[model samples]
Target: MTYRADPARYDSMQYRHSGRSGLKLPVISLGLWQNFGGTRDYPGAMEILGHAFDAGITHFDLANNYGPPAGSSEELFGQVMARDFRPYRDELIISTKAGYNMWPGPYGEFGSRKYLIASLDQSLKRMGLDYVDIFYSHRYDPNTPLEETVGALAQVVRQGKALYVGISSYPEAETREAHRILKQMGVATTIHQPSYSVLNRWIENDHTIDACGELGIGIIAFSPLAQGVLSGKYNSGAKEGTRAASSNTTLRASHVEPRVLEAVDKLGAIARARGQSMVQLALSWALRRKEMTSALVGVRTLDQLKDNLGVLNNLELSADEIAQIDEATKDGQMELHPSPKGWLR
Candidate 1:
């Protein structure tokens, strides 16, 4: 069931510079953190992956612990690359991360040198690649020293296991320190993946945006749709058999609180005025930033991916529309410090 992509697929979306790097990443990137888990619908996942590539999505985000049964996502991704994408390796930008708990014991997780290095080696083996274009620390480790984590990332670049390094969920202060350390080690911190959306605006207050801008680090926003909250899918109430209704999910049934729903209703009205779906307006807002290199997104079906891709067609967000959205979500209905990684299940 392998698929081949058309050579002209690269012309679909406009590419943006990743920070100050020479690399040009597509505006919309694919992430394998959710639906790619082995236990999920495999045919659906592969179909969506093929569709994304055919639509000019060059970057794919992954991690060592991305499956319900950890490592299955990478294993399945390897099968995908081997069967369908092997020939297009040069045209792709593959990334994987380490930092979360992939295995038992102290050495198996965290920002320690031993853990980061070993996790990446295992990720490479699972994905059947010589090197990943970008490797990230899945999250910041408050317990570990910044120097140790940054040095481990530098070591990977030196070993040729990763071309560039990135950090995820790190604070602005930590980002600055990491950039300094990595630069001193002669390895640049090229990007940062953060959770940003019309519903979630923590990065604006956290200073990560300005810090990364100063350091020339690209920001690829994850969960830019606020896990589909801004999509108006839950506005009519949660449908059965959806990710929102899944009992095992961490998003919590309470996330759709009364205020959250009220905010969505108001936001939906604003989106209708612009003649776009709430999802499109939300995604467009995130990309309107001068420092945003890409918007990394995930989907359970090809239909969802298509709807998301429509954001690029109308990225124009008027000052008034942006103001309306800001006021609607001003109470901050999207701030959740919990790990969005359900694969650890």
Candidate 2:
């Protein structure tokens, strides 16, 4: 089928600037972290991509390490780029990251200049792209000199391989330092990716959110649904194939304990009263911050994706609603590994 985008694609979608940069990303971005990998159905992935774009989602986020076999997600997305998106390349904001282990040995991961440079080349090759709109250091490397890591990002921009650079899961001090280092190199730390949701509030407690806003670094929140905890799907219990039931998933069965389900019930009640689903309520809460550029969503089914996009129906959160959410989730904690050196999983 010839993929012609919806003629009215841009009519209802909203865009927000990444920090103070001129680049505007859709309020909701599709992420290729899970279901777009090689193990999934290729045609189904294409259908999701096609529909996402038709709904005015202009940003697609990926990482070099985003698959069961590692790099498979990028390879799958490369096919989509070659087939359906070549004509609309300039209309998209494609971003990829390095800094996780992609291969073996010393230079396989981290913030080394060698690893970043080599990784970007390999990523570009795998994705069939000359450059990514935004390149990110997926995590902070405590051992590597921050300057060395950020300097490689600057080099890629000058070399025309990446237009903008960002950092993810970096603490407040490191984020401030990365911005300063990039500024010295005549580059802006355009964005930050972090795990943020109504249940997980590390960014808020650790002051990472405040730091990005103060530094003019836009935040694109991942895991806004808290690994399905906020989706109200687990109020009864973890189903047979749910993420919490999977041994390899980051969301453990233990994380969805009785206390957590209780919080979900309270949150769901608040959402239903306002005529919004639990997922949309979670999204609305995450995007309530002005510094949030987009909320990155990973969906396995087209129906799930549509449910997430239903957030467009009600985007605003009143002060009272915000207060209610806070009170309900005050004691809620999803056992996550968040720190200055790493982010929540």
Q: What is the lDDT of every predicted structure here?
A: 0.84, 0.88
- Deviation in Å, model 1, residue 91 alpha carbon: 0.7
Q: Best lDDT goes to which candidate?
A: 2
Candidate 1 C-alpha lDDT tens digits along 1-345: 447686789776889998998888999999887678767665666788888989999899999988756788898899888878898999899999988888788898879999999999999999999999999988887788989998999999999999999998887888899999989889989999888877766677778898988889999998887777777787788666556666446465445777887888888888888888888888888999899999988888788899889887888888888889888877647565424242212
**Residue ranges of candidate 1 with Cα displaced over 4 Å:** 337-345
Clash count of each predicted structure: 0, 0
Estimate, for each residue in 1-345, the C-alpha lDDT of model 2 and write its tens digit: 867888898988999999899989998999988667767767898889999999999999999988756899999989888988898999999999998888989999989999999999998999899999999999889899999999999999999999999998887888899999999989999999988888877788889899999989999998999877888888876477666665546676545878778888999999999898899999999999999999999888888889989999999999999999989987777746455344443
The residue pairs that clash in candidate 2, if any, are none
For model 2, what is the C-alpha lDDT against the true structure? 0.88
In TM-score terms, which candidate is top?
2
List all candidate RMSDs to the true structure: 2.2, 1.5
What's the CA error at residue 197 for candidate 1, in Å?
1.2
